[model samples]
Target: MTERILDHPVLGALEPDQTVTFTFNGMTYEGRDGEPIAAALLAAGVRTLRHHEESGTPRGIYCNIGHCFECRVEVDGQQGVRACLTPVREGMVINGGGPLPAPVRDWRKNHA
Candidate 1:
C-alpha cells in the first residue's frame, strides 16, 4: 500500500524548502514556520503526543482548537504547553509524554 501524504485542505502547496528543525524526545523533526507544533508533528507521522499520568494510556492530538489538554507538550524549556496553540519556531525543543495541569485563570483585583 502506498503511503498517504496528508496536506492542509486550504493551504494547498506549502512554501518550498523553508523549513525548520526541532527535537521531540531527542528525535529531530522538520517543519515549516508559522504552523502549529501539533500539525508539524502529525505530518511527520507522530501520533502519540503524551500518555496518561497514572494509567499510562497513549495520547494524541484532539480538539485542534486547544480546548482539550491532550495536545500538551514541552516547548523549549517550558512544560505543559499546548502544542496546538503554540506556533513552531526554529530549533525548538519539544518533549512530550507528561500530564497536563488543570487549566486556571487568575483575575487580579485592585483596591484603591
Candidate 2:
C-alpha cells in the first residue's frame, strides 16, 4: 500500500510554499516560514521532545497549547522554552534530548 504523505489535522490544510530549513540535533528538517517549531517537528514524524531528567521517560507534545511543558525545546541556546509558543524563523536551531525537570510553581507570585 502507498503511504500517505499528507497527514495532520489543522496544519494539513495550510499549504505553505515558503519553506525554511533548520537543524534539530544536527539533522535537517523543513518547515513553514512562520509556523511553530513543534508543528514542524510533528509534521516530520518527530514524536519525542526530550527526556525526563530522572526517570528518562520520552516527552512529546502533550497539549497543543502552551499550557503544558511537554513540548519544551531548546532553541539556539536557551532552555525550558515552549516550542508550541515559539514561531519558527529562518536559520533557527532546535535541540532535543535534554534534561527536562518538572516545573516548579511559586505561590508567592499569585499572592503578589
Number of the top TM-score candidate: 1
Question: Which lDDT tens digits does candidate 2 get at residues 7-112?
Answer: 4685574354688889888888888788888888888888887886645689998887999898878899998888888888888888876643444223433555
TM-score of 1: 0.75
Error of 2 at 89 (Å): 1.3
Stretches off by above 4 angstroms in model 2 are 1-13, 100-112
**lDDT tens per residue, model 1, 1-112:** 1122545588675446567889998999888786888988988888898887545578889898988888888788887899998888899999986533433111111221
Clashes of each: 0, 0
> What lDDT score is found at residue 82 in candidate 1?
94
Stretches of model 1 off by over 4 angstroms after superposition:
1-12, 99-112
Backbone clashes in model 2, listed as residue pairs: none
CA RMSD of all predictions? 8.0, 6.6
